[model samples]
Target: MITTNIPKLRQFYKIKAILFLSLIISTSSCAQLLQIVEQTPLSDLKLSQLDISNGLKGALDKGVEKQVTKLTAIDGFLQNELVKIVLPEELQIIDTKLRQIGLSSLADEGIKVLNRAAEDAVKEATPIFTDAIKNLTFSDAKNILMGNNTAATTYLESSTSTALYSKFNPVIQNSFEKVGATKVWSNIISKYNKIPFVKKVNPNLTDYTTRKTMDGVFKMIAVEELSIRTTLNSRSTPILKKVFALQDNR
Candidate 1:
């Protein structure tokens, strides 16, 4: 400027010089990084799409095998506090009232039968889950690979809930008959209904047990998935190691 102050002009030039140097340094750094990446071998990077898909399926299958199998065993639900099927809210009142009336043994059997039905129904779960895992797409693998610890379990639930329910409901219904739950609960409910001034109650035990069993299946699956995601020893396979390494980087 024709009448620019000397101090102001010097300050402006100094600021401009600093910005020019910063731009040059940033550009150089980016270029250096790009060159390094380009020279790096693919083996040092993430795995192929097919490898990732197999790895994800493997983890899901492992979860189904380990956790679901446990649920299928005798006393699986009855013994395991984590996935045990307890009485619903309305039934809890019945249990308390029955126990107060010196029918504690009968009440206990009622509860045990519910868990038995769930355990029986869980016997049908492994195949359904294995089929769902086999259908895992590459896109699904990519998303599940980058998702949180339970994301694969969440995906399995969403994909298999309908099929599992259809498969489990009838099995639980039959199991109730097979395991004498229907008789035990019938006696318990009859006794509860006869209690003085109590509200008469009729609940759908089959639907209730089916839902609880499904919840247990998914919960167990999530436990294994979390273990695999967090514990290196739990990976258990080379592909699992490589696929999850991508997640570790992310």
Candidate 2:
């Protein structure tokens, strides 16, 4: 090996180290500059309201499929309080009076039958709700997503109330017949009338039960909508998660 100057060699190493450090600093500075140029302000990035509305509509559709369909099944409304059908206004007084006179079991049966009729009738609700969802406009979705706890429900009622009533009425009539609601009420009223000192009670249970059942169905849907809106864990489905994530961002 040829003899080399130790001092020169040391100087050369020092220069190399300086050049390496300079290159690293320059690269780091360039990276920061690029980042500053490319970064976007969060406030400047606006989400599409239409997209948010679509997400809400999708969430509502999922809720109907998951929760509302269960109510149409046999004993569904009778068992589920959140969607349980109660006696209509005209029948409610009669039902209460009957229970007060120790006809509690009979009153209970009457209540059950009313719910049963609702359960039978709610088979019509799925198709009606489905149709309503199909007809939902962008504005409807936007308002619903940005609305209160019952916003989605209000939207549904506004758009589909008339059509749903038309569809539900005939089905409720048939359901009354099928579940013996009419017969039960007739018997209950007849028995109450026969009781000494009891006033006559002739309630139009069909109409009452129909309206109550419809209200119950809407109540259940609203419950589901509120749950998904407020509870992070309730967004269980993938679609629900993705859709609600959008809502959360808003």
Candidate 3:
């Protein structure tokens, strides 16, 4: 063309520049929208399709098998600070007084025997806990997965605590007798009872130890469940990996 109108040419290029910029912006926005849509369906598909219930049960079984099973062995409770049974509140003073009076060895024996009985009684829990996990419902599993770190353990406690207490109480009583805790505590209590200025104490050790032992078991299981959920390294099973991935992304 004859000498181009310089200003008009400049204006024309500016217009093209604006149009090109707008097209790029539009393309970027469309890509973002497409990504969002693609991700939404994938997430929905994962939640709706995955068999999380069995995976959750499997996780619990692993906890019981690996952690709880250890509590059944000799010195398991005594040696493990995490699950060690200590003196109950009513008996704490008794423990102190017995020690003060040069009966420290007896006091120590009494404490050891309590843990021993707990180790013995814990054997009964594995079967009951297995049965409870086997009966875990999908509703429970989903809520637990989305719940707080200890939610699974809280559910287990709520579902199993009462029945376990009833089952464990009797065994704890028997275990106390078998492990010689009954007689050992009898001696400790007798010695403490004879101490001057001490209030006479007759605690229901069977009930106390039963409750403490259950608490230790639940606490240990919660630790394992938390590890499996939050730490990718602790996902020892494929189901644990797949199921916990939901929590990870959420």
lDDT, candidates in the order shown: 0.90, 0.75, 0.84
Indicate which candidate wins on lDDT.
Answer: 1
TM-score top scorer = 1
Q: Which stretches of candidate 3 lie over 4 Å from their true place?
A: 1-50
- Clashing pairs in model 1? none
Better of 2 and 3 by lDDT: 3
Which residue runs does candidate 2 get wrong by more than 4 Å? 1-50, 88-93, 96-102, 236-243
Cα RMSD of all models vs. native, in order, equals 6.5, 13.4, 8.3
TM-score of each: 0.83, 0.73, 0.80
Model 3 residue 242 CA deviation (Å) reads 0.9
Q: What is candidate 3's lDDT per residue for 1-250, written digit by digit as tens?
A: 6787999999999999999989877778977876565457436747442468878888888888888988989988999999899897766888787777788899899889889988988888988888888888877887788789988889889989988899899999998889888898887778888888889987778888999999989988998998998789888877788888887877
lDDT of 2 at 52: 54
Give lDDT tens digits, candidate 2, residues 1-250: 8999999999999999999989877778977765554333212334354555566767778778877888878788888867776765555677777888889998888888878778777777787787788878866775676578788888877777787778778887887788787788788989788877766777776666667777877887888898999998887766567656655666
Candidate 2 backbone collisions, by pair: none
